[model samples]
Every structure is written in structure tokens, then in C-alpha cells.
Target chain A: MPRISKSDVVNSTLAFITLILFWFLGFWLSHYIALPAALLGLLLLFMGLLCLGRVPKPLEYVSQFCLRHLSLFFIPPLVAAWFYAEQLGNNLWLFLFAIMFSTFISLYLTSWLGQRFFGHSNQSVSQDDES
Target chain B: MTKVNTVDWQSIIQLVSIEQLLWITITLFAYGLAIWIYKYFAHNILFHPIVVGAILIGCIGVVSATPLQDYLIFVRPINWMLGPVTVALAIPLYQQIRLIYAAGSKGLLVIIIGGCVAPLLAIGWLFLFDFSDPVKLSVLTKSITTPLAVDTTNIIGGIPELAAGVVVITGILGVMFSKIIFKLTRCDDSRAQGLALGTVSHAIGTARAHQIGAKTGAFSTMALCVNGILTAIVLPLVFMLFG
Candidate 1:
């Protein structure tokens, strides 16, 4: 049987602890540290990533784990948005217009430009690779 | 004297109720549990634990009437992770430095033009519809990630919170349709796909770009970082000069 690595234990433990810390931090910040909470959250996130990098050959697995379940973490915020539904309702037209217009515009431009710039580079790289 | 000593526990208990602490613990444990489950069955795309967990939490919040704000207080820490996740893209980015450099001034020119044109077109369309200034500004920031979009919205006199909502909506829509759009446009090249997505749709676009392959994802990540900074700087100045 393969020995259970110390790094594996540490990575799993850290990921678990960070999730809880993030929640408590969010809760505390909503009441006590709105802006600071956001700042601190960003800070902790970077720290967590750094910790993730220190883990072994299974780093990809760890990242996949986070990505797969990342949306679960945002539920609280969505719920918070719901609580403010009345405010959202009052500004429905503005919100609708903003979301719709921005979505189309952003998607179109990003895709189009990304294609243009990267296409040029890819052509050059492939030519080099073939040679 | 003994009676006097026993008189004041109720107020203390009320100050920090066991029930509230229990609720907080439960919510945190749920997040941890969700992560574990997602890890267990990581192959299925639709069953993405994050989405599943979000839906579950949202349902629970609705049933409990636990003010979203109260839950936000507990969940805000997750948002904090956004910064690191974003910056970490720099790692993949560093590996692609050669490709970026080789693209050179020509590549820079293309990116700048595309970035500028995309937002202009978006804002122009909104203007045609006679949307309010706040709405227009919010739309302008939608092509970037939520954090940057929120900040850009504020600088340009739009509501940051409103920008956040727009960013989420924009990401979902972008992710859903961008591939179809790419196919329709006959854009089969990875680099072009990445840039177009990153420049126009922002993070969601980048995510879509990644789905195509590593080359596309790398370029999209680059586009996201560059476009984010460019728009943040340029949008405010454009508004100042023109608006």
C-alpha cells in the first residue's frame, strides 16, 4: 500500500479550514467589515492558492475540486441578493437593460478580439513548430 | 445574595445565542461537505458541486427566511478568494510569455483596438435604446470580471452593486452561447477564439476559451488580464472626455 503523504493530509485539511474561515469572514464582514472583508477575502484566497501550489503531484486534482464546487460557495451571496429582492424589483428595468446589453457586448468583443490576436500568434507558432 | 448572583444570565445568553453559533457552524459544514461530494464525483460537468451547493444553499435560505444579509456575513469570505484565483492565472501566463512576446506590437495593437471597439459597440447599442446613464455604464463594465466591473462602474458613476449583478448575468450568457457564436463565425483558431472571448465576455469568455484547449485558455487568460487593466484605465478617461 502507498504511504499516505503528509502533503496530501495538509492540502485537504487546509482546503477544509479555508472554506470555514471564508464563511466566518464573510459573516463577520457583512456586519462589521464590508470593504475590509472583501479585501481580506482576496488576501486569504491568494494565500490558499499559494498553499495549494505547495501540495504534490495531485495539485490538478485539488484545483479541479475547488472549481467543481466553487459555485456552492456563492449561494449565500445569491440568497443575500434575494433578501434585497424588493430593491432589485424597484430597479428592474435598469438591471435588465444593463445585464442584457453588457452580456451581448462583452461576449461578442472578447470572442472576436481574442480570436484575432491569438490567431496571428498561433499561425506563427505552428509554422515554427512544423519547420 | 445567592438570588442576586443568579439574576443576569438571560441577557448574556441573548448577546451571543447558542442557536446563532450553531447555525453558523452548520452553514460552514455544509460548504465543506459540498466540496467533498464534488471531489468525489468530479467527472460529471452538470453535477458541478459548486452549482449544486449554490442551489441547495439558495433553497435553504428561502425556506429559512434567514436574511440573505445574515448568510452573506457568513459567506463573504468566499468572494475574497476571487483575487488569488485571478492572480494565479499569472502562472499559466508566465509559461506563455514567449507566445505573447512573439505576437509583439502587432498583437498589442489588435488587442487595444478590439478591447476599445467592443465596449464602444456595447455602449452604443445601449444608447440607441435610450437606457439611463447608470444602465449604460453598468453595461460598459460587463465584459470584465465582477470585481473589476464593480470598480469600473463606480468610477464611471454607475452603481457597483448593479455591476456585480450584470457581471454574473453576462458570464452565464457568455458561457452558454459563445461556442455557438465562434462556430457561426468560422473562428476555429485557438488564439483568436481566446482573444475574442476574453476581450468581449471577460471571465466567462475566458472560461469558455479554456474549454477549447490549453493554447486557447492561455491566450484568453492573457486577454482577460490585459483587457481588464486597459478598460479600467481607458473607460474612465473616455467617459471624462466624452460624457
Candidate 2:
């Protein structure tokens, strides 16, 4: 295992503080605005952090770690899904069909539109799966 | 071997209950197992971790009669992490800003079209059936990712939980059928495909896009952020004016 440093801890702590601050902003703003507070906070914080002159190196590492395990956060919601499972009752097929069909249409239309209208002038044909 | 009759295994098991620790252990184990299965099957879309884990937990819940509330009690920590996890998306967004700017007006147009068309298609399809308003609303936000999808649905007076479920399902479908859609449309542009996947399917499609290439992943991330913002602003206003 690699040695953990104090700077890394500080950077991660600062990043978390930023997240909490934004989350609270979103939470408070929710009273007046219709948008989800945490999401709005996320957007605001992203812009702020992006525009900052001195971006912390540790922040990047911390954020990468969080994003890599994004699915872990989703597990709770999936579990919460059980509460509403009964809501599907008889329309489960309809629900599934609707989601599948709409997604298919959306993907088709969006991509087709991108290709048809925008062309590939800016797109590179080379594949770069370096990650 | 026949002398150990005094110990009651049932009492011990009941006394421990195991519900508190069960959530963390079972969920991680189930997700890990699901990923293993997915890999074992050569990353078959059918064996996606989310789907498999959900099924595994669902079965366990049904058989064991574990109340959803009990699960929620221990799962709260994971749920609480969502806010921070969402905030972390900003890092990718920041990194991809240059590419997004490079696309310029054309990219803006694509994002707008995708933002509107996704939910409109949902609304139109639901209308064809006899679905209730809440159901329609839930499906309306299916195109975006979870945090934004839940918010959009909530603003539109829809069921947020239902929207979250549908949003996840939409992502899985996007991952599974993207190739077919690309073939049918004859759109060989990987950038365009990434944009579509991210705009319509969100994270799952982004994961697929990354599999395709780095450029595709960047474009997909751009689309995910842009579409999320656009839908968050546009969907409710459209519903209000002409719903």
C-alpha cells in the first residue's frame, strides 16, 4: 500500500467541506426554488472550483476516487426502490416498456441529429481507450 | 457428536438480529458478486451489477421478510454519500470544458434538442397509454441522471422515487442497445453516439462511452452535464406553460 500523506488528508477534507457547503446551499435554496438543492450546489461548486486559480492536487485525486465508486452511492436508492416496488403492481411491463422505448428513441434521435446536423468535422476517428 | 444439545442457534441468531450489519455486508457482497458475474459472462449487459444486485437483494428481502425500513436504517450512510458523489462530477465537467467550448454553437444546439426531445418522447408515449399523471411525470425525467432526474420529477409534481428508478433503467437500456441504435441510424460518429448516450442515458451510457474511447467519454461527460442543466431548467417550465 502507498503511504498516505497529511496534504492528501487536508485536500480531501477541503473537498468534502466544499461539497457540504454546496449541499447546504442547495438545501436552503430548495425552500424558494424548485430545483434539487444538492444538484444545484454541485453545479455551483463545480464552476467555482473550476475557475479557482490554485486547484488542489489532492482534490483531483479525491474526486476521482468518488467518481470511480459512484455506483456504491446508488445502492441505497436501489434499496429504497423496494418501498415503491408495490407501486409498479400491475404496470411493471408498461413501466419497463416505456423506459426502454423512450431511451431508445432519445438515443436514436439525439445521435442522428448530431450526425446529420453537426457532421464529423470536429470528431476524431481514432480510438483512445488509454484509461 | 451427539452431546451438543443445550445451545439454541435460533435464539442466538434472533438475539443478534444481524439487521444492522447486514445492510453493509450484504449490499457490498451482492454488488461484488454481481460484478464478478458480469465479468464471468464477458460483461454481458444482462448481468449488469445494478440489475443483478437489485434482483439478489429483492429476492432476499422477499424471502426473509426484511422490511424496507430496516434496510434503510443501515443503508443511510451510502445514501448520504450521494450528495458528495454528485459534487464530485464537477471535476470531470471542469476537465471537459475545453472540448465543450470547442463544439461551440453546434454542441449547444445538440444539447438543447436532446434535453427537450427526451422527456417529450416520454410524455408522448405515456399519453398513448392510460398512465396516470404521476407515472407520466416519473417517466418524464427518465432521460437525465439520478440527482437531476429526482429534482426534475419533484418539481413537476411527479414521484421522485419512480423517476429515479426509471432513470436508472433508461441508463441500462442505453448501454445494452446503443450499438443497435447506432447501426439503425447509420451514425458511425463516436462523438455523436457518446452525446446521445450521455444526454439520454446518463452515467451508465457514459460508462459505455468510456469503453468506446477517451474522446467519446469526454463528449459523453460534457453531454451529461449540459443535458442535466438544460433539463433541470427547461422541463418544469415547459410542463407549467403547456402541461
TM-score of each: 0.63, 0.86
TM-score of chain A of each: 0.53, 0.77
Evaluated on CA atoms against the true complex, candidate 2 attains a DockQ of 0.45
Clashing pairs in 2: none
Positional deviation of A125 in candidate 2, in angstroms? Answer: 11
lDDT of 1 by residue, A1-131 (tens): 87878988787666545544654564465365323233334335445655655433343344455543434434454444344435656556654655565555545554555456554454475522100
Tens digit of per-residue lDDT, candidate 1, span B146-183: 65665567668875655665555555666666667776
- Which tens-of-lDDT digit does each residue in B38-126 have in candidate 2? 78988777877777887887777778887877776766666666776676677777777776777677777887777777677777877
What is the Cα-based lDDT of residue B112 in candidate 2?
A: 78
lDDT of 2 at A39: 70
Candidates 1 onward: DockQ, in order:
0.23, 0.45
Q: Which stretches of candidate 2 lie over 4 Å from their true place?
A: A1-3, A82-85, A122-131, B1-18, B238-243
Task: Please list the residue runs of candidate 1 whose C-alpha ends up more than 4 Å from where it truly belongs after superposition.
Answer: A1-4, A7-98, A109-122, A127-131, B1-54, B84-86, B117-136, B151-157, B235-243
